[model samples]
Target: MGKAASALDYRELARRRLPHFLFEYVDGGSYGEVTLRRNIADLEAVALRQRVLNNVSEIDLSTELFGQRIRLPVGLGPIGLAGLTARRGEVQAARAAEAAGVPFCLSTVSACPLAEVAAGVTKPFWFQLYMIRDRVFMRDLMQTARGLDCSALIFTVDMPVPGSRYRDQRSGLAGAPGVLGDMRRVWQALKRPSWAWDVGIHGRPHQLGNAVPVLGNDSGLNDYFAWMSSNFDPTVTWKDLDFIRSEWNGPLIIKGILDPEDAHDAARLGADGIIVSNHGGRQLDGVQSTAVALGPIAEAVGDQLTVMADGGVRSGLDVVRLLALGAKTVLLGRAWAYALGSDGQRGVAHLLQLIEAEMRVAMALTGTTRIADLDRSKLVSAEAGANNRAAALA
Candidate 1:
């Protein structure tokens, strides 16, 4: 791939490089995709105020999260099947994140195992967990994370059951059963010869690495998906968090919070942070966007816990918009995944550089010299600014 000027450029490259099934898996959302569209639209509708004649020399983009100093107020969010995007893709992304002085979060269903990724990178990365039905496996996973020296444990609370993503079903990507659908999937993979060679041919051990012990030997991709479909604990509730808290002694963050009540619950549970997200619009189709939900949640619990957000964040200016609304930092899900799918590690590095450069220009234009300086004052829309102020007052 040639040089990518923006995240969309890398997304286009990813579209060309990956097969239809794989691309749809990363790009599509659940049901009518109402929440998916709203996530981007609401973020774009947020206007930024412009200020002139302000000195912006020596801008410091570094910030502290969970007591670790990072290069930027952004981190690569957890992504499943990332290794299928390239050869050992999670390790490559983690290395790139470390090189860029940022954090890379590993998924519970990662194609690459945590031990391998931990061995490949210099710094400790974060781990995202999906509560499963088996307490033995869940506890073992936490022990494995602690053994790997994971910095934080992000407990995902939204997906009690997988959402209905019709695009995946239509594309034969979500294990649609039928000989014709199977043939179509095979044909699609055959068309992407380069991807097949790199990920299919050369990329051995296509099994879900972290789930190997429970799944036993000779488990394939289909078996992994089958396990996931049957294993997610639907009986989970707020009280179950005590089990996780007892097992993990590190900084804990509750992901998938989009309501003030949920945010307050996280804070009351002694969580160190709360991530305002809608699973990147992959869960609950008609729900509100993270951009719309973030302000109120932050206002309700910002004083008690750290607030972060992720959903339809495509650029550095979007990062600024999120911070102006109340997030201390933001996470990128599809942004870095697209880069990795397009050009592997180099693509992720370039994307990070592009976002950082964009953020610097945005901060200078908005008359802010530090990440801490961003607030409702920098918002161009009076209503948007007022919403945040009301959140604070409430």
Candidate 2:
């Protein structure tokens, strides 16, 4: 059999297809991207034992989450402005996620309106909130989500103030580029004629789906983002979470948690689950990688709340590392975005299938027949001071 395709192959294709600003916004991380590098390094350091002569016939990948049977344990985490990646980006992503038997989360800053996206897809997708300062506006957004019959609301408590993503500032992502920069960006757009012809010219306008009357019939795209940033809530706290609980009754998930203490706080606030994330290393630069922090948070509050994790998850092997450490499910940020930017709906579907296929092989090599059988025992702690931590130490 020929060699399985590498993620870099897909990434390279995506890079070539996307405009410079959009690609950098999705790919770049905060500060020096130290946390980003650490996220991958820590996961790669984990060693799984490959057993020999094991009967590996049937593989069961199905798992239940929030009363839904997911084909795989991975789900698409909400990313802002995903629609910019492709035409009707949120709708395409949701449809692809649903087709793959997984839940697609719509962001507060998505391109399509909530009703429009809900109308476009048949499946009940999750909605993410970027809580703003205006209480009335927030209420209307929640009401809209409820009216649409959304399955869950993932309250992203991470970005009260947007991260200092230097890359984005450098790339002029926030608004219209300067004269020379605008010309360069347009030139970059021409390089990907398909994206320009399909999305840029013929597709529906990209507008935030969840923003209600504020963005209602906004005159231009610049006004939309200006309104979003100006009104985003900066004083959000644990008590604000309580207020959210009072408003929305569907399964409530608190995303943007990195510390175990915060995880405990979220569970105590009646959170059904907590996504242990550093916002994909987008928010904090010096923070501990989410992969490294997943174990402690899981051990701390795994019983109280469903523990999920995300950050630097580039391959199926990374998923195995996260699960072995104690994550019930994992979220992919750039993985799906890359697919959307490069090949539209089919690309995202193919990417999910590829990850599922890789999970099967990883499980087989480790002599596990089911995803539930994956445990810490299957993993030997990385060689510690030249000692066999898995065999020699306890």
Candidate 3:
């Protein structure tokens, strides 16, 4: 088989495979997408100080999160309606993650059932949770994940309400009509002949796997949406964290922490780890990029819990940037989705290979032998100075 190239290769391929509506849902950001643009720009600004004539042997990218060992320090982040991107997108993505020796996190809103994905991958993976008001429903969801042998539970604290993705509105995929565009997304779907043939004709177009039992098939997509809007336990408090901790009995990671204080709070609340993320600029607009906040958050509570960050992570070099800032792992949200959209399982696997190759090449260039050897000293940008401040704050 021919070798795959870059993340952009996968992205462009996905653009070709998925319909315009589905692509926008995964690719677009909220409001003006200022945060989205910044996430990529800020990450790019941190340049790696390459060194020469150093012993670069055995570029080990393996990392241990909670208790599970992964091949790399990057894992696929949760994406809602991932299946809509491709035929059974979550399963395909999970299979790719398994092939790469990293964890694939399934969203609470994914189309494939949790157990089915687990059965597809033939290994333990991480499950992302969106706490709901219904105790019985939440318990069942947790039980399903547990039965599937998921190693950890990532409780997403963000996404209490969906963000206003103007691109999705423009793509004709969104629920509401916006001043920016019209809702005739069906025409765009007609244009994507591949999707209408593969995704639209072959299987279920869009369905929330977790909500199937609750709303039942008669409920349909509209009912699923209504149930989720009403069901998610948005009034979630720290005390609720304790409740989740009691239930899962696994590594409980609290995602969506932007502030150092909250990172510390996640540690105090019995969280096994905390992901410093801004929901990929999909939630609040004009927020500080996760990369900008990572170093500080890592410094504040790095010793207490695992420090991971996600937002605008496009390449392996960005992985190094995050590691320098104190992130043990970097979550790939759009990158994985981009892969899924492009060529389904093959596309995702190719993207993972590219990232790993990029990271190994980067390690050789930086004259570093191991991931732990990387630190602030390698980065000359002002962000490194900010990371230092985050450490001081802690």
Candidate 4:
């Protein structure tokens, strides 16, 4: 692809490189994608307060999360089947994240197994867990994560059942099963010869790595999806946190928290942190955008638990916006995924450089050199904007 200066540029490159099904899987959201659109729109609307006279010489973006001193307040959040983005994609992304001095969270539905990821990177990454019905399997998975020296456990709790994503159906990722479905995806793959040669041909045994033990070694994507559909425990409640805590002694982060009440509940349940997300607008169609939901949720549990957020974060400017709104750290989803698909480990490294550079400009212009100095003070107040509008109208 051409020069990729921003996450959006990488997204375009990814679209050109990947097939229809793969690109749509990474890009599209659930139902009509109302919440998905809202995520980007609301984040873009966040106004930063720019100031001049403060002598901003050096800027530092370093921060600590779950006891790890990361170079930036950004982490590569878990994305399933990320291995499909490139050859051993999750491993590539993890290596890039390590080089960037950021945490990488591996999904339960990942294409690369936990052991493989551990083998690929010297530093331990975080792992995301879904509420599965099988307790035996759950405990085993937790044990496996611990054995791999994972630094933290992120338990995602928003998806009781999978949301209705129309794009997946249209792209033959879901609804169409068996040989017909396989053929449909293969046809799309054939069109993207670059991806086919790289991920399809070279990247052999494209199966969900973690699920292999349960779903059997011969299972395909459809089988994995089908198994996940039946296995996800809809009856999951706060009591499930007890089970998680019992199995894990590391920093426990509850992902998919969007409501203040739920954030309070997570704090009460003794979660180390909470990721204020709506599952990237993949689970619900009309929920509040994370940008709109983050402030109140952070207010509710910021002291009791670390407040992190993810959704519609495409640029370092967007990262600054969320931090100003109250997020201590921001996890990137599609930004790194697109970069991975566009090139691979090198692409993700470039993306992090772009983010860090953009953040420097933002921090310097906002008269803040430290991440700790970023707060609501660096943001344009809604009340002030409204009053300015009113005075102009009068």
Give the TM-score of each candidate.
Answer: 0.95, 0.93, 0.92, 0.99
Point out the higher-scoring one by lDDT: 3 or 4.
4
Q: lDDT tens digits, residues 1-394, model 3?
A: 2334778666677777677777877888899999999999999988778799988877888878777778899999888888777787898999999989888899988888787787798889888988788877888889988987888899999777766778865665656444323335456667888877667767574578777887666433455546666776668788888778768998889999999888888988778899999899988999999878888888889999998889998889888888988899989988888877777888888888888989999888998878888788777767676787799999
Q: Which ten residues in a row have the lowest lDDT in candidate 4?
A: 216-225
Model 4 clash pairs are: none
RMSD of each: 3.9, 3.1, 4.7, 0.8
Which structure among the candidates has the greatest lDDT?
A: 4
Model 3, C-alpha of 293: deviation from truth (Å): 0.5
Q: Give one digit per residue, the lDDT tens place, for model 2 in 1-394.
A: 1122655456777788788777898898888888878887877887887887889999888888988899999999898878888888888988999899988888888877788789888978888887888888777888889989999999998888776778876776654534665576677778888877887777656556566467675423455557756887788889898778788999999998988889999988899998988888787788988877888899999889888888888888888878988988999889889888877887788889888888989999998888788778788765542476446666
Roughly what TM-score does model 2 have, to 2 decimal places? 0.93
lDDT of 2 at 298: 91
Model 3, position 173, has a per-residue lDDT of 62
Return the candidate ranking by TM-score, descending: 4, 1, 2, 3
lDDT of model 4 at residue 49? Answer: 95
Instruction: Identify the superior model by lDDT, candidate 1 or candidate 2.
Output: 1
User: What is the C-alpha local distance difference test score of candidate 1?
Assistant: 0.91
The predicted structure with the larger TM-score, 1 or 2, is 1
Minimum summed lDDT over a 10-residue window in model 1 is located at 173-182
Ranking by lDDT: 4, 1, 3, 2
Candidate 2: clashing pairs of residues: 111-207, 113-209, 132-233
Top-TM-score structure, candidate number = 4
- Local distance difference test, each candidate: 0.91, 0.82, 0.82, 0.94
